[model samples]
Target: MTADTSMTTVKVTTEARDRLAVLAAEKGQSIGAFISGVAERLPTAAELDERDERTRQALKKFGIALAISERAEGEALWAALDAGDDEALLKDPDA
Candidate 1:
């Protein structure tokens, strides 16, 4: 790697500076090095898109499972209510 002698100035809020200082100290790094490390490790747009898609798929699967469970419970409740079985109506069908 070539020597990185370039310099740039960044403006940040006092609170942000304090937080970065604490984090840099914890990692035994200078504030500039800590910030540079973070910039280098940031996820690409494609990686973020893939993560979002996976999350959406997982949520969709969960929603389908929840819908199926609700339908089963509703059917069980209606059946017990129609039969006038109070004990059965209060019981969990999946238990």
Candidate 2:
């Protein structure tokens, strides 16, 4: 081992060994160089983003869900507006 670098021998599974060999060949890099490059440029686990999304989920089991809001049903006013009854709208504020 030198001050610049130290080599440590380690064991890997047959599948891992084969995959490393293929990757090294494809990238035109020796096995040692490929492994070293991977180790040097590897992204941090904290930097990796994981998204969890669910469709048509039921959150009832977890806890009670509060109602967002209750909108006033201004059905009559909407109906008058749809009919274009300007006179009726002015006559009755509710309508």
Residues 1-95, model 1: lDDT tens digits = 23687989899999999999999999999999999889878978787667666765787877833443564577678888889887886686668
In the predicted model 1, the residue pairs found to clash are none
Per-prediction TM-score to the true structure, in the order listed: 0.46, 0.42
Error of 2 at 72 (Å): 37
Candidate with top TM-score is 1
Model 1 alpha-carbon drift over 4 Å, by segment: 1-3, 47-95
TM-score result, candidate 2: 0.42
Model 2 clashing residue pairs (backbone) = none
The 10-residue segment with the lowest total lDDT in model 1 = 64-73
Query: Which runs in model 2 stand beyond 4 Å of their true positions?
Result: 1-3, 46-95
